[model samples]
Structure formats: structure tokens, C-alpha cells
Target: MAVLPIVITGEPVLHTPAAPVTTIDDDLRSLVDDMFETMEAAPGVGLAAPQVGVGLRVFVYGWIDDDDVEHRGVAINPELWLSPLSTAPLHEMAESEGCLSVPGERYPLRRAHRVILRATDLEGEPYEVAAEGWLARIFQHEYDHLDGVLYVDRLDHTNAKTAAKAVKRAGWGTPGLSWMPGVDDLEG
Candidate 1:
């Protein structure tokens, strides 16, 4: 697997919802491997298919520890299952999030503290994962990217303005950042 270039924000492909993978052929297998490679190279906890200019409902995420080092692996064609059985009600767990596509821009986003998801492996075997803490949040964030949503879209005004300035300073506009008020900074 090779590390592929990430498609920045504002790119037409990034704004469009990705297509579902109907077949688990060699090409799809190769793409999934490449996504993991790219994600590892980016040193991010997760990566999505659209970030690599592939419009597929696919993403990979893993847990990161205190040293800012990520634990590696891949999750393909992720299908989130918000458990309705928990009477405790999942609360917000805010964490600073970054993306392979957006590069250096980092912002905070609030996500569920726990989640259950059903996804297929690269081999097309069915697998179900129940994740909590950081892993759960990372999955949600990266999965959103498959649908053309960025972490910045979940930010508030103050953080959004700051993020905008960061994007402008970095010479990236909409193609590198998404603007929305009050949805992206609970954890920063």
C-alpha cells in the first residue's frame, strides 16, 4: 500500500457524499490499504476515503495515547450504530481533532463518549466494534468525512474565526477548511 495525497476541503469531491462500495474487489482492497498507509503517514488517528479523492463510504481510525502517538489499523465501510439501549445517555467528549486533508489546521470537536458500529473488514468479513472514549470520537469524526463533512463544520464562532484565520494564514480557503459557528471548539 502506498500513501496517497489527501484532497483538501472545498474540492468538489470532498463536498459530495461518497458512493457505497458494492464489491470488495482487488481495487477496493488496494484503496483500503492505501488509506491506512496515508493515515499513518499523516500521523492522524483516522482517515476517510474522500480525503484521498475516492468517493466511497469508507474510513479508518484508531486510538492514540498520551504521547501523541497513534495506534495503527483500519476500519472499512464503517456503519455507525448509536445504541438506543443505553439508558445512561451518551454525553459529549471533546477532543482536539485534525485531518489528513486539512493538514496543520487543528480544532476541537465534541463527539459521543461511546458508540457501536458495524463495518466490514478489508477481506469483506463482517465485524462489529463497540468503542468508547477517544476511539469512539475518532470514528465519528472520520466517518463524517466520508459524507463530506469536516470537523470545522462542528465549530462555534470564536473557534471558527480562529480556524478561518489559521486557514488563511496557511493559504487555504474553503478547499482546506469548512466554516460553521459553534460546532468545532469544545475541546480545544
Candidate 2:
């Protein structure tokens, strides 16, 4: 499998909702493989099809839980259900989130702490998984990409201002974004 170049935030594909995977065939399988490879090379815990310039409803995630359990899988045409976000203050619930598309930048954003993900696997088998904590955060972040929403879009006004300043300073506010060779190093 090859590592595909990840699209940056300004790319049109990153802003458009991804198309569903109509057929589960060899090409789909190959794309999944490449996505996994790319995620690994970038060292990101999760990645979506749109990030790789493939407008299909698919994403892959790999992460080690607090208990040291390794979890990895693919979600195709996934539907995400989030638990009620914490009633805590935004600053309390919001945590720093980063994205591969908007590399080298991070900002605080609030997200659900629990999620139920329903989707088909690479082989077209349906499955459901309940995730909490960081895993749930990953699901939400990647899910946003499927809908053309980036983590920055979820930032509160104060943080959004900060994030915007950073984006401009990095010269990433233009029509094209640069790809970072490694995975995002910021917390999510």
C-alpha cells in the first residue's frame, strides 16, 4: 500500500460532503489499505477518505487505549451518534484538537465524550461500536471530515479567533494546503 498525499484544509474536496461507497470492490479495498498506510506513515490515530482526496465515505482509525489495548478498524458509510456532551463549561469540556489537514495548529474545541458508531467494514459487514474518551473524540473528528467540517469549525468564538490567527500565520488560509509528512502531534 502506498501513502497518499493528504489534502489540506483549503481544498474543495475537504469542504464537500463525501459520496457514499456504492460498491465494495477491489478498488475500495485498495483505497482502504492505502488509507491505513498513510495514517500510519503520518502517525495519525484516525483519517478520513476526504483527507486523502478520495470523496468516498470511509475512514480508518488506530489507537491504543488507556489500558494499553490496541484498536484499529475502518468505517465505511458510517453514521455517528453522540452522547449528550458534558454539561460542564465549554472550557472544561473543550480540549485541544488537531487535524492532519491543518497541520501544525491546534485549538480547544468541545466534543461529545461518548459516541456510538454504526457502519460497514471493509468487507461490507455491518458493525457497531461504543466509544468513550479519546476514542470517541477520534470518531467525532473523523466524522466531521465526512461532512466537510473540520475541527476548527467547532471551535468557540474565542478559540476560533486564535485558530484563525495561527492558520494565517502558517500561510494555510489560501486555496491550497501543504501536506505534513508526519501525523499530527497535537492532542485531540
* Top-TM-score candidate index: 2
Question: What would the per-residue lDDT of candidate 1 be over residues 1-188, giving only the tens digit for each residue?
Answer: 78777766667667788888888889987887887776666666787888787888888766667778664556667788653333452333346767656666777666677887778877778888787767777778877887888888777677778877776776665554432212233113
TM-scores, all candidates, are 0.78, 0.92
The lDDT, on a scale of 0 to 1, for candidate 2 is 0.86
Worst 10 residues of 1 by lDDT: 179-188
Per-candidate clash tally: 11, 1
Q: State candidate 2's TM-score.
A: 0.92
The alpha-carbon deviation from the true structure for residue 31 of candidate 1, after best TM-score superposition, in angstroms, is 0.9
Q: lDDT tens string, model 2, 15-46?
A: 89999999999999999999999888877899
Worst 10 residues of 2 by lDDT: 179-188
lDDT of 2 at 48: 96
**Candidate 1 at 47: error in angstroms?**
0.9
lDDT of 1: 0.70
